[model samples]
Target: MINLHWVILLPIILGTIVKLISIKTAKKIMVLFQSALLISATMIFIEVRKNGTVLENIGGWPDTIGITLRADLLASVMVLLTCFLFLAMIIFVHNKNYADHLFFFLFLSLESLIIGIFLSNDLFNIFVLIEAATLIITVLIMYKKANVAIYDGMMYLLINVVAMSFFLMGLGMLYKKIGVLDFYALETALSQVKDPQSLILPYAFMITAVSLKAALMPLFSWLPKAHGTPSAPSVVSAILSGLYVKTGIYVFLRLQIAFSPLIDTSELFVILGLITAIVGFILALAQKDIKLLLAYSTVSQIGVIMIGINLDNPMAYWGGLYHLMNHAIFKSTLFLTAGMIISEYQTRNLAEINGVFKHMPAVGVATILSILGIIGAPLFNGSISKYLIASGSSGTWIESGLILVNLGTIIVFIKYGQLLFGSSGKKETADSDILEKAVVLTLSMLCFLGGIFGSELIAILFNVKLTVDRLSYSIKILLFIGSIFLGILIYRGLFKKTNRLAFITSFELGFNEICLSITLFFAFMVAYLKLTL
Candidate 1:
């Protein structure tokens, strides 16, 4: 059996070796190495499923005394996701001129750090991995050094550094209280502690950092700048939005579990998630830059995923996890295809580019499919997970909130749909990469297949069996169609002729303002814990 640690380390080693080779040779080597890495990740996942969670302590030390590499179901599945996304992205950029050996070195190094985050069981180890990944991603975001790339990269770095400090403070507090850095060990020790109140401040400090990383409302000011930077490569943007932001949520889930005995703030998170979803779409609806629009959409989708996880319902929990995977697929397709369209049209302004279906039919098809998936069209992957989430929210105001969020999502994308119509008046070119088009189209198809087989996918992904209610599903289909028409009307009536919400686009938060929000969030969590727990 392949060791999980190798899956974490081989990428850095291969990246170093590839960096010394010529570009042509490097591409070839990276292709082979990434494919093998994907296979290793899959085998680890299979091993986890068959034999239960796999754990190996560093240097033959006991689990509580030494650093541990662990691969539970969630960790293994996330590792599988990491490998798959990296492989797809590698192929997507394989033939590009800018994807030089240096780029591959940094790319593969980031991959190793992300996989390490998934496998690490120690709080300190996870923090170190996140810090390393942050620096690499900043370099990637400023890779082209165009426009305000440097400023954006610096802002991203500073904000995350401050956020991670909170995480470190919380980690230190946790270690002091429980005398363990391993998550399971902390959980056990916390269970026997006399005072549950001692963990409240640590929870507040840690969750504030995680929420910001997850791009929750008010704390998400950095996401649009980082993910939508004009100079970043399309592949870099795709992976950051698709896979990177997800790491925060993944860590939040793990830590929340460890702290479950003393704290249950699911209700508070549910409210916060709803606010994030609403704010995300409102801002997304105001964007004119194509990539910025997609970036804000990522924020909105993250909110929906957060809502699902915190709903305190098993169906919604799985729905949230499934939606996380589904969002990665469709969002990556959107970013990659948006890059292609921007290159062809030589613009990122949504109004300036049109006739995608007429000029670049393949890219248009992929974009349309992805749009459908994101808006939760009845038969797309999003619809299934959203339906499950809706099912879990049945008979509650949360259900109504979900409807509002879905409606806003519909309106936002309907405005985006304009890119697929009208004429851009640019002559069609024959220079587009066939492999790039194929990768996106394949992901788009996965969106459809995932929805069609939603129940089966849920079972396979999480080992949970669920049967969708036929009558409820029928109602959902009707609601989806109705939302589309309503969205079209709203887009035309309110957004098309007037700049009613254009002011939203000008809204920006400075470093101090963002820091204030983080402080407020931490204080709020502390208050909530004091009152609730």
Candidate 2:
């Protein structure tokens, strides 16, 4: 039995060696390594499922003194997802020119860093891994070196660095107060403390940083630029939207658990999430670039996931977790398809490109399936997750907020669906490679199959059985249908006529402004925590 620790280390070690080899050799090695990694991750996940949470202390030292690697169901599931996604990504980009040795090296290193973040039981180790991943992603986003990609990369780097500095300060405070960096030890130590309120400053610092990382409202200015940068490879954009952002959400979830004894900020997060969702889609509705539209949609989905998890409802929590995975599949598919569309049309503007369905039927089908998934159409994955979240919050404002957000999502996608029809005067571009189509098709099928077996999937993934609420499900289906019509009318009446609000859509916060926003957010969180205490 291979130790779980080595799973995280092997990728980094192999990636380094592959970097020195020829590009062709590196590609072959990466494919094999990623395949093996997926199998190994699956084995680890199975072992954890059978044996319960697995733990290892590095160097044979005790948990309190040594670095601790742990894999609970959450960590194992995320690791498995990461492995599968990275392998799919490798396949997706195989025929593309971006498969040079340096790209693969950074890509594999990123996989290792993400795995490390999920598995690390030490808070400090998580911090370090996140920082390393941030640096790597910065380089990847700007690899093409065109059209403000450098500025986007630099902004991404600087903002995250500032956020991590806050995290480090919080880590320092945590160590000073609890005398341990290990999560288990910190929990025990925090429970014994007489004044839990004293931990508020550290909690505020860490969560503020996490909020930025998660791209919450007011701090999400960097997300569109980074994810939609003209120069970033489609696979990079997909990976960023699909997996990397989830790391922030994952850390946010962990932080909430770790700090639960100190504070219950669930209500605050719920409100913040609702705001993020509303703002995100509104911005998305105003975008002309296809990639930016998808990017902003990601911000909205992240917010919805946030709200679902923080609702303090178990069913909603499970739904939120499931949605995280679903968003990854559908959103990545959208980005990849959009990349192909942009490449073929020689333009990113949705208004100019037309007749994708006629020109590229397979890509069109994938795009439609993904659109169904995103809009919570009755038999898609989004419906299952959204239904679960709604059922968990019957008659609450949160439910209403969710509906509004869903409506906004529909409006944006309805506009996006415009790219699928009409006539393109130009001839069709080269057909997408077989592997590219396969990747999108597979994800689209998962979205369908997931909804078909939604209940069973939830039970299998989270070990929790849930009965379907038939009436609620019917109502949700009805609402979704209504929203589709409403979205079309709204788009035809308003969005089609005006480019008003173009400024808000194009406006980006400068570094100084972003820093100020972070500072203000930290202050607000601190104040809120004090008042509640």
Candidate 3:
């Protein structure tokens, strides 16, 4: 089979190569370009049909000098996601002006960088692509004329750029000890490091860098504002909230898998994941802007995936990867649906979106199904991984915390339900775009069917023992109960009274950012201390 590593990078490279000045034709040309990508991705997905990993070494150098490109189960799943979601986004903006060449450039640039991030075997190359992704996405967020959008994008840039700095520094420090810049090299070397200072410092830096990108706990403040501010294309939002965030998580997963023995940090990840899950949902309850609420909810879900990785059980490990793919599917659906509502109603204020289901049946169904997914409705994608999260651990205390997270997820989504179904005292009116309807319906069906048959999909994607009947049963019932009763309870009790605007000025939010910065600074200091003292 022909290696399509270059195919992944083609759109961006070609887009930059052919920078046509006519914005009128830019959208048309961009769609054609993306169509090509979709084709390439589809073929690649088919090419890697077996439930295993594939590696292509570009330039045919020795394995040490070669740039290795791998299409494992994980990479194939992402390719399908990016292709579908990105196409849906293109359809969403079909009628609009694609006059800005820069937006198109950034959009495709992001796509290329994403493929690179996943496929790159070298740590330094991954770090470079990560930064490139951050740069383009920051610009893409501010594609509109909104000041809030600029503020959001700027802060996102500021925070993640610092993260990239940390990432590169970690690479440099690791190279100083291990004399290698590739992930395969580092992973091979990681198990051999004996010095506490040499090992701990680089690993710590890598973790912080990835944690910031993944927006776990303290590093999550920028996501809501940045993702919420711009009227991003449905596809851009999908990539941002879905796959881009996973880059960081992927980094974490690779590091942990390769360096698990060198690190005794599972419980540390658990503690942080707990905070991320709880705090994100709490803040999600406080949001009146649909985008912001969903953004915070994404943060919460990240914590959930993080929890899965932290548990270290085989079921939990695969479950985390499962949740990561599931989140990409369903959460992107939620964001795309929200984007439709915003596009139709011309607002992000969920307070005004009451009864949105009444007029737009397609959108209503989409919203409800998305909410169900978030709530972890049975057979749907979210529940499977979430169930594993709660049950993956052995301790009563961990189980109890997982329950709280589950309950919290249920409650916050209830807030979403209310926001759509007249919680804020508005009626759903008729204004359905065919494009929006098609996109939402397709994604909703994907999630719904994905849920009922995800076991098969999981088996095909990864050789894990995830069967439909095996995962189906009592757990869904308990979660559903929470989704109904406790959800309403949290909605009316704590969520109903929460303020949305306060997030910008809230002490909790402010303190979170300040604390994150301090933690990062202290991390740097510790590196210096580890070396000198």
Q: Which residue pairs in model 1 clash with each other?
A: none
TM-score of 2: 0.98
Which segments of candidate 2 are over 4 A away from where they belong? none
Q: lDDT of each prediction vs. the true structure?
A: 0.91, 0.89, 0.73
Q: Clashing residue pairs in candidate 3, if any?
A: 355-422, 379-451
Give the per-residue lDDT digits (tens) of candidate 1, residues 1-533: 78878898999999899867788888888888889988988898889888999998878998888889999988989999999999989999988988987788899999999999999998899999999999999999999877599999999999999999999999899888778989888888877877778899888889999999999987999999999999899999999999999999999998889888878888878888899999999999999999999999999999899989999899999999999999999999999999999989899998888898888888889999999999999889999999999999899999999999999999999888899999868676436798898899898999999999999988877778988999999999999998888988988999987748889777689899999999998998888788877
TM-score of 1: 0.99
lDDT, candidate 3, equals 0.73
Per-residue accuracy of model 2 over 1-533 as CA lDDT, tens digit each:
46888889898888789877787777777889899999999898888878889999899998789889999999999999899899989988888887787888788899999999999998899999999999999999999987599989999999999999999999999899889988888877887877867998999999999999899987898899899999799999999998899999999998888878868999988889999999999999989999999999999999999998999888899999999989988998999899888888899998998999888888899999999998988889999998888887778989999989999999999889999999877675457799898998898888898888989988877778987788879988988889889988888888876755577864778999999999999999889988897
> Judged by lDDT, which candidate is best?
1
Better by TM-score, candidate 3 or 2: 2
Give the higher-TM-score candidate: 1 or 2: 1
Q: Best by TM-score, which number?
A: 1
Off by over 4 Å in 1: none
lDDT, residue 497, candidate 1: 72
